[model samples]
Target: MNINLKYFKEGLKDGVPIALGYLAVSFSLGIAASNAGLTALQGYLASFLCKASAGEAAGFTAIKEQVPYLEIIIVTFVANCRYLLMSFALSQRLNPKMNIIHRFLLGFYLTDEFFALSISQDGYVNPYKCYGAAIIGSPCWCIGTSLGIIAGNILPAKIVAALSVALYGMFLSVIIPKAKEDRYVFLSIIGAFFMSFILSFTGISSGIRVIIVTVLIASTFAVIKPRSTEDE
Candidate 1:
């Protein structure tokens, strides 16, 4: 197994955005975990395993509601289904000649941010590149989360409250760009809120119900839309 310094450098460079993005997001997760009654260690553990923001949010929501563990797992899995697509995309970029062990190792680090960076490469990813990403990106995620947990404990309540806004701000940052570029995205946002508001009046589980409604509505639209001739 030859270690390529170039690929390592490339992975490190590509992982910079991931590190920065995780910093803000993990900070908010720390705050949320603390508020949700998780200890700092537990919060760090959540960040280490879950990594996905939506999963953590769903888990915390379930915890708050005292939902069954099965429901929590299901919600977290559903929230992260998009990662299946990401993983599929990344598989194409890996070296075909690589062994199963190598592939398995690569798959372990197939995070959205890491996949995005890996696929953006000009050619097939060497094992060293995947190794580099796992080495650098994994630590960034884990360390940032640990730091967030620590900060959550040390920071004053008022300061933590102010910092909590950063997560919403991050969400808005993603939403604004998609809304500006696509009318359908803008409509979906509005539709989601409307459905959620309506569902809130019911006595059933609002969060789970909202997720079901959104998925059903979105999937129905996708099925009804005419496919391009090229796609066919």
Candidate 2:
């Protein structure tokens, strides 16, 4: 085999873990989608194209609740907006001499895992390695969603209902660990929970409620919390 091909294959081998991880997480997303009255095609397509599980989940929730289109747009934006920062950071790691198309594609596939791995590479990153990682992981995400949706349809309603809660559990799993480390974050999370609970009882719609609560809390924290000069 050619040296370049062999090196690319090595990158694919490294992506095995990332692909497996994507499979599990997106499987949960599929269940969420199924529960949300989304079609199987919708579930897999969203996972395949967006490649951002959190954003997709937020969007799915909005859809499930029958929130307005504008609110859906806002929720998805707020959820996935962090990717812009990740992309900016990843951009600095690439060789300036690399192709612009490669740079664009790299940025496109620069998920949290792929970016971390690419940035860890010594010196300027080879775009091919990132491609290798994306090629493996992206398909796994889509495939997992497809399988989950399919399984949800075939399973009993009780099983599907149980699986749907996995989305909330996933969010908690992501937040609780970090919240444990920081008092501010912990407080913010607790505050958000209370706010959400309060909103549930009021005449306020889910769409407006989410927008109001998220903007209010996040902006307030942005002003009061400490700011760091370096990026995460």
The lDDT of each candidate is 0.65, 0.74
Can you write out model 1's per-residue Cα lDDT over 1-232, one digit (the tens) per residue?
A: 3357887776776555556556666776666665677776787777767777777877876787888878988988777776666676567666678689877766776665656555545567665655665666566566666666567656555655554464444356546666686676677777777877788788655445556666766766567553353421
- Over 1-232, each residue of candidate 2 has an lDDT whose tens digit, in order, gives 8755765776697677677778777777888888788888888888877887778888888888999999998888777766766676677766778888988787778676667656655567777776777789889889888887788555465654554454455346546876787777788888888898899899865545666677677677778896474423
Name the runs in model 1 displaced over 4 angstroms: 1-3, 153-232
Q: Pick the candidate with the highest lDDT.
A: 2
For each candidate, what TM-score against the reference?
0.62, 0.64
User: Residue pairs in steric clash, candidate 1?
Assistant: none
Error of 1 at 80 (Å): 0.4
In the order shown, what is each candidate's alpha-carbon RMSD? 6.4, 7.2
Give residue 49's error in model 2 in angstroms: 0.9
Which candidate has the highest TM-score of all?
2
